[model samples]
Target: MPPPSDGTRHLAPAKVNLTLHVTGRRADGRHDLDSLVAFADLGDVLHVSPGDALTIDGPFANGVPVDDRNLIRRALAAAGTTRAVDLDKRLPHPAGLGGGSSDAAAALRAVGADLGLDALMALGADLPVCLAAAPSRMRGAGERVDPVALPRLHAVLVNPGVAVPTGAVFAALEGHGPPMPDVLPAGDPLDWLGGMRNDLQAPATGVASVIADVLAALTAAGARLSRMSGSGATCFGLFPDPAAAEAAARRLDYPGWWARACTLNPSAP
Candidate 1:
């Protein structure tokens, strides 16, 4: 059955890479990544209605393109469907939060487009996992996504209001690092996660020095573990509990910085 003509709302949660290890570089120039990915409670929202127009509005919607260049449009085209979309762009772009890809995936679901994994991936590397919108292990230039069991986690996400180009960060990578262990530890996820690393963090910090400051602030705010997410300026701090995470988010005082406390692997609404 087709969705009602009024509209349908979809959540586009933020994608957080808790552990990102660059294992190798593929012949196609894409890096092979071994990472544990998760979704946060907070993210953008999309409302899709039956039409062919696309409209965007939200705090971060000022500069986003609305034409065919936008991922939402491309996704609709790829699915052989069209819909009027109103995107509430909450997350900052190019912040390693996978905002655009998540929005694209939401559009596909809104129109009931069942483009398979391969077709979805062709739209973007992160599309597969964003479509799943669940905790998973991602590998091989993001072509592999295996859902994993993960407990709900309290975390604070921060963005330093700076752009770190993905290409520049990858170009700065000194060398590929080893992949994560074949099996994750059975005990505390935080303990195991603390030992893991985001291979792109160093190079990304090099690209934007402010990232180091964000990590330091997160650690100082009593985060159990702190790390940069994806390729850039956004970082996450895992807290012991919701109260601690919320407190830390409140304590992080920096001009022009964005911070919010959220739960990872939260139940779908």
Candidate 2:
């Protein structure tokens, strides 16, 4: 609120979909989904200062749009803040990680907007969970968000530099959907997540074959469990701890592939 006291920084953590079960298709072509989402410690950063301009800089900032098309711009406009926003982009774009949405959510909270759920949904399907910045069960095209406590996860994220369009993957899907269980089985996070899967993975692999390679590398490098997140091309592996996850990432050295070890933020209230 009030530009976060000016010059304050906010985190835009990477959104990881541990489980995404595509259910049914709506009349408008929107797909219904049930997903369990968590935020990663590794992600982009945003800084706010007293001004109206928006500036972006980071390793992955070269081709990101900076105008109204950018979610941050729209978010700031929606929040009615003119704070000079500087985004430090770290996560790879179109990598199945909701980087932009997370950044926008951070901007909204920074501006102290009290918009309702419907308003936030207008920003993006992932915006609500990103705004909460916590582990939650997301359903019905992301309109329903219920925060849930989850054990911390040590994970390695890998992107093969290929952007997989979400629409294409969905279009390539063969079946209607396999509905996810209403209640998630509780236990160790890794074990529970290992049994679940991203329904989009098969179709997404058809779009980007390299995604298969990414998953293979992760598994071969000693990952207990590995799968693609969200849509495609950016896969993740769950390890026992940060050290193991980091070690697995380092071992899977592929030229031009982006890989990092991060802990999933424990459930936030």
Candidate 3:
């Protein structure tokens, strides 16, 4: 059955890579990565209506071209829907927040009921887990997922007002980069994440080293763990408590960088 109203609203959360180890580059131009993925209690809002066309709107709608290249459009097109897709912007773009991925997931499961997580999995990696809206380990070309128990973590996300293109960052590696860890540490998630790593950090740092500076600054601010997500620019620091995390965020002096303090989401069902 078609959706009752013009559309159904859904919340799409930004993602934090608790651990991202880019262990190796594969033969088919794909990067081999092992990442511990977690969702934030905070994210953008999406309203998907079954209709005749696609559209997007919000307060932060600048520069987000409503074109065929946009992930939401691609997702709706892939799902073979003509829905009027409206996305209220919240998460930073290309700052490694996984905004596009999350948006695509929303369009699929929330908007197009005919397609589910498994169906979208074949469309794009990260879509399935993103639809799940929980923390999971994504591995083997981003196909494998292990949904693990994660604690409610407090964190601050800092993004220098720069859009770091994922392709460019990966291309900058020139097919040469560090590899993902063969085995992650076994312990409490906080402890494990504290020791976790991001494989794309180096190339991302090379493209825009300010990300490295952000990591340093967050570490100086008493962050237990700090690392870049997805590709570049946007970095996160995990603290023990919400108060402590917000306190640290308030002290950051990156006037041009976008920052936010949000609690880490407990795993979703």
Backbone clash count for every predicted candidate, in the order shown: 0, 0, 5
- For residues 41-154, could you state the per-residue lDDT of candidate 2 as single tens digits? 778889977887888999999888988999988887887766788999999998889998999988888778776888788989998888888888999988898987777888
Name the candidate that leads on lDDT. 1
Model 2 residue 232 CA deviation in Å: 1.9
lDDT of 1 by residue, 1-269 (tens): 11223458788899999999999998889999999999997888898878988889998998899988899999999998889999999998889999999999888878778988888888899999888889999999898999888888999999999989999999999888889998887889999998899999999999899999999999999998999999978999999899999999999857899999999987622
lDDT of 3 by residue, 88-122 (tens): 88876766877877877777667544565556666
Q: Assess the local accuracy of residue 140 in candidate 3 as a C-alpha lDDT between 0 and 100.
A: 70
Number of the top TM-score candidate: 1
Q: Give the whole-model CA lDDT for all candidates, comma-separated.
A: 0.90, 0.85, 0.75
Pairs that collide, model 2: none
Looking at candidate 1, what is the lDDT of residue 47? 87
Measured with C-alpha atoms, the lDDT of residue 219 in candidate 1 is: 97
Q: Which ten residues in a row are the worst by lDDT in model 2?
A: 1-10
Q: Order of candidates by TM-score, top first?
A: 1, 2, 3
What global local distance difference test value does model 2 have? 0.85
